[model samples]
Target: MPSPRPDVHPPVVTGIGVASGLGHGKDAFRQGLFEGRSVFALLARPGRQRGDGSPPFFGVEMPDPPSILPPRVERTAGLSGRAAVAVLDEAWREAGLDRVAPERIGLIVGGTNLMAREQFLSLRDYAERLDFLPPRHGHVFLDTDICGLCASQFPIRGFAHTIGAASASGAAAIVAAAEAVSSGRVDACIALGALQDVSALDLQGFRALGALGAGPVCRPMDRGHDGFLYGEACAALVVTRPELAGGTIYGRVLGAGFCADGCRGPEPNSDGQVRAAQDALADAGLAAADIDYVNAHATGTPSGDDAELETLRRLNLGHARVNATKSIIGHGLSAAGAVEAAAVLIQMREGLLHPVLHLETPLDEGFGWVRGGMAEHRIRHALKFSFGFGGSNIALVFGAPEGAAA
Candidate 1:
């Protein structure tokens, strides 16, 4: 089948919803980014500790979103599902998507562990007490039920898919939604995803791998970089054809490229990243020189950031303004890409970019790092990178409103 021409049917983002450690909704998240303050506190309860007997690591856990789901079904939906419902309501409301028919709308959910939290909690509780307290009911304990539950609460009636591709899951979901809309499969589609605070399973796993940071703080790409802290966040985006757009477009998903690194271990090479960036440029019919800036997937890991920085140099994107936000907002696992992409769209819309947090020493001399404070620039076109653990790499190209300030 021949590829559809975007010129004839362009896909655009009409609305956004976010609930993260920074705060709830768009304004709160943007304000937190502007301040460049870290909201991380001592783990509310407790997690694994350093072998040296330091206090357990710090993390940020987002409070439950406004209660919008029916109590009966809410009990069975899991935290991920509940978060998705709240954000989808916000995005759907803002986009005026109610006018669209339920049958024409599509829903896609993404995350590293779509049902990890629910499954873990249930089994852990049972193991703690062999004597059963109460029996579980509905789909709350099942990951496969996420898609069906979301279909019932929201107007989405078309295809419902759950994508689990590690950290790039959310971005992968967005790429799929864009293709669905661009191909005329649906008038609009919502990409929803959420990650619970780092689970004991993940904490112990990353810690055993020596991936957690020693300092309470995390500095992405810093010379003293350690590792990432798990952050809780839920985000949703509404993508629809330009003709059906109800609100001003936040940005256009002009092009997307998805690839794999084939890395057997934690650290990966830069070749796959460079390839993904190249594919995005080609898909958008653009050149490396045409791009304005990049939102890097630097999650504060030394090896990962090193490889990503090398990829930027190889692509000759050192001149482009690049910002790493993981320092301000801890990595949200599969939700990182979607949330970070939202931040990029916000920066493009505002013409101001946030500075890297606590980055005193530089890791690479080639990067045009936005440090000290926010920087203002003419950003018409930008790039968003989503590189996940286990070698998944995705690149996305975003553009501001046409005929607007460059």
Candidate 2:
């Protein structure tokens, strides 16, 4: 950990919106998270079913997002696109961005190939009759389509684009959004983690890679941890300078760090993970001992969880309370980072840390672990870790709003 520069005034998180297996909206997510409720089940979607008569994969699927857009737009915007609008709308209204100059606002969407299931269904249904294929497929299939849809719905004219860093996409988007505001490029920016609509092919691919669990249950950090259960989720965070946000401020983005392992495989690299956390602590101008909590990037995979735990041990954050958000909601591949960031903010505001579900056996007992039920703990400074395949690792530091009591 290194000292932070005093002149750095990082962006603050003013509003957050989430849709997860817990339910839709911020309130639902907060309640369900702290209550330790889970909705995992055998995935029942049409395209999600295996064609070879194998057991269905286990996951948590969210209900279709509300039909809020115009009929024409709704027709073109598939489930993933609709989920993006639904989640971002809540954050936009909460951040009071409507009052800001349209040109001063920007948007960043996380994740690529976001509409796999939608494309899969369309191709399957129209394979014989290509003439009956929807005319809007051309516009909707591009990853940037989400960016276009969001920009059209909101008055974001400054700039808009997408970032795809595997599982770290959401964290990358947040870091980029924070920089955009800090550099005065935009007065406000929205970082959205779009839903990953995984098709049967996608699920099978993971299963083949030994990264997807075929479940009676999916547990992270436990000795029996096998693989990750795919969960459908979308989250958005509205970030701006403290002076620009007149509404309630959730927290501040103190600093962020990113690193690449140079390897192109799915294997976890402890050195890269450790460096990212250390860099984040240095950027925030705080020592490792200053951190009060950590939201770990534990995805239930044996190698992944082991690597993260080793990284934490090396960082010497034994004094900080630790928990895994994926334990309750399942894994939201691209959306995990933003959604877990939202979990961090909600816990900080409520002064209670959520419990890790089904963590019966301890992998290591040196760090403070929140288990069984919610623990009353006020977080002053927290760290969030998001690691993706291909060796992409990211770390973000968040702090309680200024003048708030600890």
Model 1, 323-386: lDDT tens digits are 8877788888878888888888889888899888888998986778989888887688899999
Q: TM-score, each model?
A: 0.93, 0.98
lDDT of candidate 2 over 327-375, digit per residue (tens): 8888888898999999999998899999988898968888798998999
Clashing pairs in 2: 4-285
Query: Could you say which candidate leads in lDDT?
Result: 2
User: Candidate 2: what lDDT?
Assistant: 0.89
Counting clashing residue pairs in each candidate, in order, gives 0, 1
TM-score of candidate 1 relative to the true fold:
0.93
Residue pairs with colliding backbones in model 1 are: none
Q: Model 1, stretches more than 4 Å misplaced?
A: 1-8, 45-55, 128-138
How much does candidate 2 score in TM-score? 0.98
